[model samples]
Target: MHPTVSGSGRLMLGFQYFLHFSVMGIVLPYFNLYCFHIGLTGFEIGAVSALRSAALVLFSLVWSILADRYSARKPIYILCIFISTGIWSLYLFTVDFWMILAITLIYGIFYSPVISFLEAFTMDALGVEKTRYGSIRVWGSVSFIAVVILIGKIIDLYRIDVILVLVLLGASLQSMASFKIPEVKRSRKHQAFLFPITLFRKEVIVFLGCAFLMLASHGAYYGFFSIHLESLGYTKTFIGFTWALASLSEIGVMIRSRTLFKNYSLHTVLVFSFMMAALRWGCLIFFRSAFTILLSQCLHSITYGAFHMSSILYMDALTPDDAKTVGQAANNAVTYGLGLMTGFFMAGALYEPIGAKGLFAISGIIALLAGAIFQTMGKRIKVFPP
Candidate 1:
């Protein structure tokens, strides 16, 4: 493993995450609300979201391959940020469904690689002591909470259109932050270690499949949680607080993730996360009170925080150094891209017929299935030790 990165370098990396996810926390939680404000229906919103996921799936592999092949990540990382900033600005001028769809696709091309490449760069910077990844990544959760709460209040006082400005500002700052990450030098020795076909082994496939199901089950929450609250007569400020609560819980989990990794196998953590996800969604189906919803949101710690951190560590342990980027990309492609695409599409279809409660109940079932799949892996899968 390469020497542990200098303390300043680690801080810069953490700052980059803080900036990037700050943009995401603003955009991801509220984009559907923006669509609603603009007169788009649930189905129309779903179609737009699915297009974005499609772009992620289509381009994530291409970008990750390019990054891995050239042994370069920083340039692509910076390019993606600048380009996303430009594309997001176009939102100010367009509102037609088709036009919005086209822009989302274009945006996806540049945006898809952001997280996957960053994960690869971060893991590389941290080397074999990968547990420290959570320490740095938790900064993202902190920033996300700040952005969501602040923006929610702004939107409450002003209008949803202001989100475009916030998104643009976040993207601009993210581009600047990207410059602080030092370039990762690629060695010729590692260049030949491309993504291997053997990665499709049954255990790995099961892992990816379970990850996909877990993420897919989150479709209702990600795509429509804000709108659902709004329809229930909750204020935008309250909605934002609920979203911030999830990130707050996520922050607690990430802060302790290294210790969690120290005591449990990645497989064990994943199973626990999936189970918690199931319970969280189930609670969302039956509960509408503020207290219950806030309590349910706390499970975000297990559902996304622990699950995501565990998945990264698992991929790092399972993949060769040279193929790490590709591994991370594949994880993004399957779970975030394909899984999210499926979830949003289905939620759109089922939402009108079944309503939010039914949608969440279905999500609970899918989470249970995901946990079942992971259970089947059992001792066949290798566990990462402290």
Candidate 2:
């Protein structure tokens, strides 16, 4: 309905989403399998996986701060993509566990910046009619499903090493897309040492903490869920399809997030998202039935898709334009980088003793705790650019 938001803007956002998620599909469904194929143990894989998040903890804040200061988003996004794709491609040559971990560590530092900036850029492109964001982001979910299914078929036929080839191709395409995206210049000029942490209000801190807890809960799933499925006698292809099904559901939810957000507050969405995530993981722990798992996976819409969209919108609505990119980045730093690193490490160390059942149960509990925390922060937390 808004003039600033256009079909063209949606198209550009969708294209960007496609590249970002396609890269993810290639990595998520296959990376752990590749690690196993090369001789890493479950513990080692968990450690290596955590290394990526650990690196993000170190660098995500710095990158987000840069985007806040610079205002030119596209160039920094491109640099991160090129770095991510380049280092992750190292899998083709290395079988050493430490080497793989090293690659993951380096890749995450650069890769973490893209999504944070891209969210800010896309919102700028959309302006008042941000309703279109979900429609555009759903394309990413759809592309992810397509790639996961395609790569699953390939893994069914060929050796797991073939995954690296797909990953390389995906990253290359993403980098090219990043290059083609036109830059959006922000109007607000920020001070050079505008450290947001110094000015972060209680609400922002609470929101960031809740987001961190939610992502931390996903640590087991993102780092090792694929491997867990395989360990449970599920084939790589079946595991891939599970991921695909979840994405399909996510796409559906994404298309409706605009309407959903219109009716609900951002805090309400976040609380609901974490509650659903708790349910999703809790259900996963109890039912190994394929249909049950499939249904639970579908709830990923509420769990991840809704959670992510709401977080960004909340950040957008609450923060100043000058601090928008930094806010997103700070959330990522704490959530993906720090929280994920912590989750993966805990999940890794605890995996063998607890098994998949116990691991997912913990994830569920954490989600519930996050939801409770968010509820407590309600109406009391400060909302702002400071």
Candidate 3:
């Protein structure tokens, strides 16, 4: 445990995660629906979504460098929350494709650093027992389940525009919560003018490559899963339930992540996560029945829950203390930024002619390839024991 972080502080951080992910649950899973509601075509929506990642790729490194240079994670985080909230609010007034694309790009620049800084804060607070991250992070999943279900019903009864109100509310609460977190102290020495290119050793490169492949595989699901379900005649309520089911399953994996870490190497866990992702996407290719969809979602426990936690721990172990924030930004830039950009753009182009089924089938194959690449890491990658 970090000497400065009290138990109450930990609880507050958990609440922050809860608030942040609540906003994500409302917006992320359904933003495509909102785009469609505002009259954008599938290709335009994908371009808008891809623009967000492009901004992240462009700006995350700049923000992370500033955070590390000034040792000001909390200040950067609070400013990002306010800026992103204001920019995101513009969505309510804009129906034009160009306008939405511009807003999303700007919003992504500010939003990119939020999670990376939070990860750095949380890891510092956890100290040596980094695996406990999942315990605190699981609250995010809980809030996601609650908000997704609630917003789904709200959209079902009212209109998708109501999601904007909920998103703004979550952002307001998150900004307030940011003030409660104590500023974490770190060494200001060894600040580099440029990110250390040498950090990309053979092992790190392989890990990041596999991570990119896995997230790229997720492009179809994240960008179009809800629309796909709706197209198949599933009700909004049922679609929300499926999302909640995945989060609920994620909670189980998160709560038990420490035990899993104790029993398995991070490499082992991540390889398994990749395999499960492959299987989950494979199932989506052939089976769209409610039961099969829900069953496939069960794999979220490993695909996201385990993969995310393990990746953070792995990165924490690999990077120096002074460079943690920048390290995390690099990881995010590769996995969520560039990787997701490729996936969204490709899925968008493929969605019309190839369809969701075909897109996911390709995703499954990519995930399998990612797993194979990770397997080659073998004993080269280090795993921290619980």
Residue lDDT tens for model 3, 161-260: 8888789888988987888875567767655453675256666788888999999999899899999999999988888888898999999888888898
Candidate 3: worst-modelled 10 consecutive residues by lDDT = 190-199
What TM-score does model 2 achieve against the real structure? 0.94
Error of 1 at 45 (Å): 0.7
Question: How close to the true structure is residue 87 of candidate 1, measured as C-alpha lDDT?
Answer: 94
Please give the RMSD of candidate 3 to the true structure: 1.8
Residue-level lDDT for 244 in candidate 1: 89
Which pairs of residues collide in model 3?
Answer: none
Put down candidate 2 lDDT per residue, 11-55, tens digits, no spaces. Answer: 777898897888789787788778877888878978987888877
Residues 131-225, model 1: lDDT tens digits: 87888999999999998999889998998899999889888988877888865576744442465552586667888889999989999889888
Instruction: Assess every candidate by TM-score.
Output: 0.97, 0.94, 0.96
How many steric overlaps does candidate 1 have?
A: 0
Preferred candidate (TM-score higher): 2 or 3? 3
